[model samples]
Target: MTTAPPDSHPPAAPPSTDVEALRREVATLREESSRLRRMLDTAARIAWSHDVRAGGGEPVAPAWQAFTGQSLEAFGNQGWLTVLHPDDRAGALASWADAVAAKRSFSTRYRVRRADGVYVWMLAKGTPVLGLDGEVQEWVGTCSDIQDQCLREERAAFLARAGELFSSSLDAAATLATLANLSVSAHADWCLVDLLHEDGHFERSLVVTADPAQLPLATIVRSLSPVPRDQPVYPPSVALTTGRSTLVPEVTAPLLEAVAQDANHLATMHQVGMRSLLTVPLMARGHILGALTFIITKSGRHYGDEDLQFAQELANLAALAVDNARLLQGARDAIRLRDEFLSVASHELKTPLTPLSLKLQVLSRAVKAHPDSPLAPVIEAHVETGHRQVRRLTELMNDLLDVSRISAGTFRLQREAMDVAALVREVSARFAPRFALEHCPFTVDAPESVPGCFDKPRLAQVLDHLLDNALKYGAGTPVSLTLTADGAAARIRVRDGGIGIAPEQRSRLFERYGRAVSERHYGGLGLGLYLTRTIVEAEGGRVSLESRPGEGAEFEVMLPLQQA
Candidate 1:
């Protein structure tokens, strides 16, 4: 036990604690903790940590407590799953457990209850922090708010589907029903469409629900007096009257009672389990078409401003489709009426014209017989003018009859073996007088024998229309008609040096009642080209136009030599 020298021996035992070193270590830990808290606060990431060994009994992070309004004591033992949506909890737990067992990364999506009681969608991801032994020490994760993004994606998909469904049909009632059904299947538990009649009363156009078993109840609800105008508190009535959207996020008993009509209605309303209501006016072209009502029931969805906006968008599409259907129906009705009138009038007028034409011919013969008399020339001229006028009237009546036949799908062709060149020459000869009257030069280039099996009368009529247009629009310029046998088809071209069609007007030239020039300036019905095209196509031929503004126009008709 000899005492060692001061230099070799260890220094006298230090103080019980090195105060400076301990203080520095404590300061460093506090700075680290403050830095972590600042990082968590600044990022959208909601930082959370779970003790791997503690299992369900582990304490939750302060961020989780703050974000979800779950305190450590409240979250004790049960784990964070207690705060998750019932539908999402099991899936989230399964994914998290798998990641923990494998000691790897974890990722999942879930709906968690917020302080405001709304279950918001979140994307949570975690990375296992391993100890030195390579076992999982803990799990560090962050939950990002994805509710708005999820809703936006869902809404976009729904609108795309709705657009397709609405545009698929043109029937007004069917389109309305589709809207209601689509709304129920996508966003709402129940949907109803109410149309406003001309008498200012509402008619329940349709009602649809997500649950088929509830259809009977939905029918009863639909049958309920179509949202009386007196009840301004009713969602549909309010929307229709104000022509604005209405949203009730929460449907309270008092509100239901306020809107219910009678005891049974009230009881039925209660049974409906309405959690929310949204109504939007269906409007088009400055008129209110109807009201579209959406209701959330056992689905537990609340109507917010965003939902109201979506409902209004849907209402706009439905209204447009309904209005378009109505317009189309009205047009069809008008066309039918016009066709009926034309069919009756043409026959009635033609009945008198036959006898009238006979009388004109008799008078013309009697006047010609008195050619030696002084007044014979004057009377003969008058009679000839009467004959011309009757012919013009007959042509007009025939045109109207042809139009009616085409519209009714009764236009038929009597095909025969005939020379198309002879037909073209005959039609050109008929227009010679008119071309001379207008001082327009006309020419026809054709082979003497261009025979084909075709509808001779219809082909003659087609040539007649083309020559008539050339004579009228030739503007006193040269007009040419060329017919040839090209391969297995017969080609006829009528070229006119007159006011040519504009590019845009050419497309409408063959449509019924379509005209490029003003009717006030030109004196003929606009049906000539339409009839020509119909007759030509019926004979297994096609008519095409080549024209430009301020230039000449050329119309070509290609007819199959052997009709099939």
Candidate 2:
């Protein structure tokens, strides 16, 4: 009835009792395989294999192609090496080769390239799969992206160290020193700082080379001799001038020659082995204050845009730190200037008193005749001097009052008939002590009487400035002061043996804050000559100078007999 009549087929095999169990086992294995693939996807890891005998390598599973977004053809025999960063390639390969030959486990970390040409940190690990008889059959490996974790940790650590260095001191120079030391092994081998002066000029402020061999070169460039002041060129100069960033991937002979101040400089560059350079202008509030330069010397490292970007960021912080330190130093300098002026003013205030004692000699006879010790002659002679000194003291309140007022075009003068010769004599006697201290022989020549209608106090100030300038710029040479009268005016001449003035500076000699000498060699407010000219012109007089470098300088002033 159940088709049993169809006995043509052989006897049907009995249904095994293990059939259902076998089916269950197969289902379990399928579930496990799916779960493993899901796990691989979630971990961002891809499996790969290499058959030593077959002489080829490929992804053991499709996960590698999916994760890397790369085609099989693109992943050549040494595809892993192609993704390895240049800096880490050699070490990574060496490690892998050793492991593959020994048929052992291996692990390493390095930057790997993605399909889009981006590089990232990756942890690659592999193990050898053995065949029968314990011989090596194939090698299995996995690749995972660890770029984010590694970069995050590294950045956090570096920033923390950098923050500590920056906060350690408010001194811009000191902070830069620390930065240079810390960055020598990491950022660059040499660090340089160029600072902008208030006059809109640049000077090398600092140079540091971690490598000892380059110290001499750094010294020569920074101290022995400096860049030409006339040329406003170079990478740092361009960056500062344009307020942008500049990069020099390789330091060529022509580049070195162009920047070299002399043959010796070019030779020094050869000894230093300069390779690459990064120049970033220190900018704040829309103005370029200076430039920070980082150089690769002896390291032979390639600096890319990201490197430049990081350098610029550090430069920004450096600029801020430098500005902050400068501000603080300025405040301190202001305080120091105030104190110095106070001391100088006090000394100057006392200086007039000594000259008054000279007048005392002239008043002795008259004073002796008065029964009450009249002291009338003394009082009469000193009345104007005391008033002038009092006014001079008032002028000291701002320390720069005279210069400021003159520059602001709000200066005024009071005139009277004064004996020019007598005032000159008094001032010369007052300067005797200072000249002696400088080992300078000073002489004064004046007629017995040279009368003029002038402001005595202002004339005294003018003489003081001229004399001070002569002594300061004299270079320890003799100074001479001469006064003579002409047909309509009285002339005073101050000459000194000093590093003299250049012809170009003659026109601006009397300009306010004009400097005819290097600050490293001479220092002042640059207001002395200007003040002399201003006061003399206000009194219907004129000022002039004559000089040549290494010869000496002579300053002359003319005072009209009549008021302007």
Candidate 3:
């Protein structure tokens, strides 16, 4: 070889044999094919080839036959179409026909029966295999398992809808009925919600079915008394008793017999056609309120872990809604009863107070008439003390009446042109004797006249309450009232040198029954500031407080000069 000419290069080693080159190419192709098959298997995708022109073709993909468990001969005759869900067949075929006519890529989603006899969602996509002339020769496609993804999306949508229904209102009966109806429409053929009452009794709160004709049969099923919790055959009872979810994948005749209460019950159960059931206890705040039962009928759907989880989520929402409604109703009833009691008590107390006031006035006059008598001073002192006590009772009765009126939505204001300065002076004079008794020095600063359209009696009441508050808590310290008019509003501030409120207590001081002091030390209902704030707000005004512990507190009221 070395002796040959440099240009020849020893015949180039026979050009590397045609058979060896072909073998290397074949090996490369085999490796690529194996990689593609691995990719398809890992992705749960089955590839198939169909000859549209011939209407059918022999199964060429072992994956397809393995996935559907179809024999080669059966698959050749298009037996795979039989595995498609009955409800989806018509639409799927129609889409395929359209895609074939247009000679374009095809994509669709449908439920397909698996080798295990369970239906799973699949996303099928296909592309036309074109020949050299750009005419379609056949179709190549893939079927991918999308069951988990579809179920997740479905569950999310269902819960979102359930949340909307639950938030619509705090009415228990209406909301539970809506929830039952929604369940039947989305996930169940029938839904029954049974609630456990406080008296340990069970009541079927709602029963809804998808088919209108089945309403009578549902009613019959509802009439059948629930099975005892000791018997684990009944799902609802089991769920309610254990406070856990129960799922019955399939309902058998023997199981139905075990759950039935009587012959009529068994007959009704058969007529209702329950195929599967899921029950979840309605849990709220660590308590089980009830059980929500979901039943499948002719749809032949089965309840699985995913269905149970969804039902549990729905039940949680339902429980919260029901609990909230019940709490709200309870509060309303309590308020109503309190208002009624206040109205009657105020009226009854007033009835006796009027005559007592007259008697005290008569007694005072008689004692004054006998000024020359030896017992004149003692009798006079006793009568004055009695008068003070009577006045205090009257004030309390009036406050109760006002609260009742407000609660009943009957509180009204009579606005009239009046001198606020004059009203403030009158209230101050009325409270003068009380301030003196408590040894609290009172001072008032105001203009001679501040003209405004306001509710006179209500304003007087507000002034009286503020002064009394100062007298009670001021503890004989100096109290001052300052009044000023500024730009469409009247500002009145009462500063009291007494046991000042803590910063934390100020926010709660304005709510009904909110108090910063104990009843043992303070001798009035905790309604004064609440009533004051309510009146001020109703008149387009505001009230605020400024104070620190052990420092004097100043309460301010700003009222619109003109009534709305």
Candidate 4:
């Protein structure tokens, strides 16, 4: 990209002799080269040419001095390295050397010191200028300042990293760590994430600094910050109370005097060379969760309006994390409370079952002994009714205990080798009198011996629920209990000829407190089917039902033969 130099002299009038002609040609070429150099500099591009034979030399073009406001004497051969950023100097030099040795073009990005002493990003490049016979002559290149574009790209990268971190986890601690790492990038020297408690007290949840050595000191100082809201001294505290952002662009003496709560905090601020600060409240669903604090110190970086906007974006992610953690914690607390209540309530209701059962037994024995008496028939009938009532009460209490065990995560079964078919027959016999009372025919089809390992009482309870469900809903319909088994598992079926379940009701019939029919027509705790399913699954089994409106419902319980 050569152009005419500001100072150029036209070739002298042609000479009549050979020596004069050669001299005139040389002067003409020199003026043309000077004009090209001037054009390159005027374009605001640093055009440089290094002598390949000398290995390296002062730039043949004066573009560097013209653009940077530095003299060529100041940038003698290889002196350009002095103005390069220390981190980029070694690499830039090595690249130049390799390009020259290989006689090829080279390009790289590095930060160069401008005349104003500010470092600006530059794209340095070089291309070999070949002579006749394909011999390398010089390396020509230009350096274009790309500082503003580079800054913009870096900022975009920072925001992308922050977004990735926020989406990676829901844990509060991990989210805090992400925020800390984001600040470590060019944004700030230190970052802190704080959470407000239910009582409106601030908890310094996390504090991080890009400088590893300063982390401990930052943590200690943060622990003592957020002075009383009435004082509203620190930026973090002010941001929290107002539900807005606070900025301390310059930590001047007057600013420190007002911000610091005491000498200890002030000393820490000075020790950390805190200069600029921004604190934005972490808000979630219109609720202030906490604050995200960012600090710039001796790094000379200051907070600006764009920085405030960036900080608020980061704060939003922090707020979402805080809100998610709070919700999970609240759910846990509620479950804990519910389990405790279930345990207490079950024990209280079960306490009276023992005495009630004993009293019913005593009454039966007395009526049996007075069978020949005149009022024997009526007394026997009353005793039988009492027995049925006692049985109902016992089932109710047992359901409560099962629910409590399930809530406590302590539901267990005592496995014993037995004939499952025989067990079913025994439980069915207990329901015979009730079937007779309701004028419903009852039947049981069970094999003589279908061996398996199971909790006898739990199986009996399951049978009680299935049979009772049938009798209650299918009151006048015939109720049948059947047991069958293959080599791998045993299956029990309870089918009733009553009003079938509706589609909507059947779906939720197995849920706790779920009722398929109105209480006015049928009475139950609605835990029968739920407990049935729970106990069956706990024993490595499954329960399912097929029902249709106006048809009948058939419940099938399958239990695996093997139990561990």
Query: What ranking of all candidate models by TM-score puts the best one first?
Result: 1, 3, 4, 2
- Output the worst ten-in-a-row residue range by lDDT, candidate 3: 7-16
The deviation in Å at residue 221 for candidate 3 is: 4.7
Better of 3 and 4 by lDDT: 3
Worst 10 residues of 1 by lDDT: 56-65
Best by lDDT: 3
Winner on lDDT (1 vs 3): 3
Clashing pairs for predicted structure model 1, backbone only: none
lDDT of 3 by residue, 335-442 (tens): 999889998989998898889989989998999999999898998899899998998889888888889999899999888899999998888888888888888888
Each prediction's TM-score versus the true structure:
0.80, 0.41, 0.77, 0.75
Question: What are the clashing pairs of model 3?
Answer: none
Q: Per-residue alpha-carbon lDDT of model 2 for 126-170, expressed as tens digits?
A: 899898878788887777888768855775576678776787788
Alpha-carbon lDDT of model 2: 0.76
RMSD of 2: 22.2
- Candidate 4 C-alpha lDDT tens digits along 1-564: 977788977789655797887888999999998898787676546777767678755665455765566677777677878888899999998997898678788889998877656578998887888999688877777788797689778777877877777777867678777777767666788887777777878878777777778877877866775644575868778767778798777778778877788898788777877878889998999988888888887455578787888788778877887688778778988977876776677677668867887886887788788778888788778877877786787678778777878877888989888889888888888889889888888999988889999888988899999998998888988988988988899999999998999888886889988998888878887899999999899899999999997778999999999776
Tell me the TM-score of model 1.
0.80
The segments of candidate 2 whose C-alpha lies over 4 angstroms from its true place after superposition are 1-122, 126-139, 142-160, 199-201, 224-233, 258-261, 338-564
Model 1 residue 307 distance off true place after TM-score fit, in angstroms: 3.0
